[model samples]
Target chain A: MDNLNVLDIFKALSNETRLNILRWLREPEKNFPAQQAHLPKEVSIEGGVCVGDIQEKVNLSQSTVSHYLSLMQKAGLLEAVRYGQWTYYRRNEETLAKITKFINEEI
Target chain B: MDNLNVLDIFKALSNETRLNILRWLREPEKNFPAQQAHLPKEVSIEGGVCVGDIQEKVNLSQSTVSHYLSLMQKAGLLEAVRYGQWTYYRRNEETLAKITKFINEEI
Candidate 1:
C-alpha cells in the first residue's frame, strides 16, 4: 500500500459527480445492470464496470468521467484494472479502510 | 446526530490550513498551551481554544481564520461554544465518528 495523501482524497471527493461515482460503484451489480448484461462472456466483469458504462450512468462526457476516475485513482480512492482495450474501476477497499482509520484516529 | 452531510465535510477539509487546524485542535494543551495558560482562573477552558489563539497559531488574518473555522463548524466537523463574548471551538467527536462510519459503510 502507498502512503495515503489525505488532501488528495478530500479534493477528489469534493465534487458531487465524483462522490456520486464512488457511491454508484459501491453496488455495481444493482446500479449498473445494463453494463453487466452486456459483458463479454469470456472476460469476467468481476473486476468492475468499464469507463463507458460508468459514463453512461453518470450522464457525463467520456473525457469528463475519465478525468474524474483518474483523479480518484490517483487519490487511492479507486483501483483501475485494464482488460484488453477496456478499463474497469472499483473502490479501493484498502484505501477506504485507511481513510476510515484516519477519520477515527487522526483528523 | 444530524444527517452527516458528507459533501460539505469534504469541502470543509479540502484546504491544508483547515486540515491542520483540526489536527491542532486535537490536543489543545500541547498545541495551544499559551492560550491554556492565559485562561481566566474562574472560567473553564474545558470547552476548547479561543478564536484568537487559533488565528495566531495558524498565522492568518483574523477574518481568514474565522472564515475557515465557520466553515468547519457549519460542516459539523467542529463544535463552537460561546462563553461571554468569545467563542471557543473544538472537534465534534460525534460527527467525526459518524464520518468514520460513513466511510466504512457508505462511500
Candidate 2:
C-alpha cells in the first residue's frame, strides 16, 4: 500500500455496485446483521463479512462479487482475510485515510 | 453541486490522463507555464487556463480533451467558463472539498 495509485483506486470505485459495497462495509454491523446472525461465533471478525455474505447482500453471482472484492483489495481499499475456506473482507482504514489525504492535498 | 455522486466522481477519475489533468491543474502556473507566457493579460483569469492551452500540454486531440473536460465539469470536479471564443477551465475547489469530505466521512 506504499504507492497507492489514484487511477487504480478510481477504477476500482467506478462501478456503482462496488461503491455501494464499500459504503456497506463501513457499517458492517448495521448493514450485514442477517449474515452476522447465522455466522458461527468462532468465524466472525469485527468489521469483516464473509464473501458469501457479501454476495448474498449484493445479490450478485459469487464470481462477480469475488471479482469486485479482488479488485478492491488490489486497490488497497479493502483487506481480505481467509479464515478456513471462507474469505472475509473489511475496509482498510489506513489506506482509506491515505486516499482521503491524497484527495485533500494531491488531487 | 448539491448532490455530488461518488460513482460519477470515480468515473471521471478512472483514466490516467484525466487523473494527470486534474493533478496538473492543481499547479497550473508551474505545469502550464509555456501556455501562460503568450496569453494576453486581458484574457487571464486567476487559476484559469484555456481549453486549447490544456490540450496542447496534454498532447490529445482538441475533441478528446474537450470530452474529458466536459465529463470532469459534469462531475463537478472542474469549472468551465467561456471567455470570448475560448473556454477556460479551473479546478472547482468547492466541489473538490465536498468530495474529500465524502471520502472521509461517508465512504
Deviation (Å) of B7 in candidate 1: 0.6
Candidate 1, residues A1-107, lDDT tens digits: the string is: 23999999999988889988898888897888665444568767564888988999899899999999999999999899887787899988888888888876778
Q: Tens-digit lDDT track for model 2 on B40-75?
A: 777576677888888988999999999999999999
What is the C-alpha lDDT profile of model 2 across A1-107, one tens digit per residue?
34997788889988988888899999987888665554578757778888888998899898999999999999999999877787889999988899888888788
| Least well predicted 10-residue stretch by lDDT in candidate 2 chain B | B34-43
How does candidate 2 score on lDDT? Answer: 0.85
lDDT of 1 at A18: 93
RMSD in Å for candidate 2, one decimal?
Answer: 2.1
Cα-based TM-score, every candidate = 0.91, 0.91
Q: After superposing candidate 2 on the true structure, give the runs of residues whose Cα lies further than 4 Å from its correct spot.
A: A34-44, B34-43
Q: What share of the true interface contacts does candidate 2 keep?
A: 0.86
Task: At residue B88, give the lDDT of candidate 1.
Answer: 91
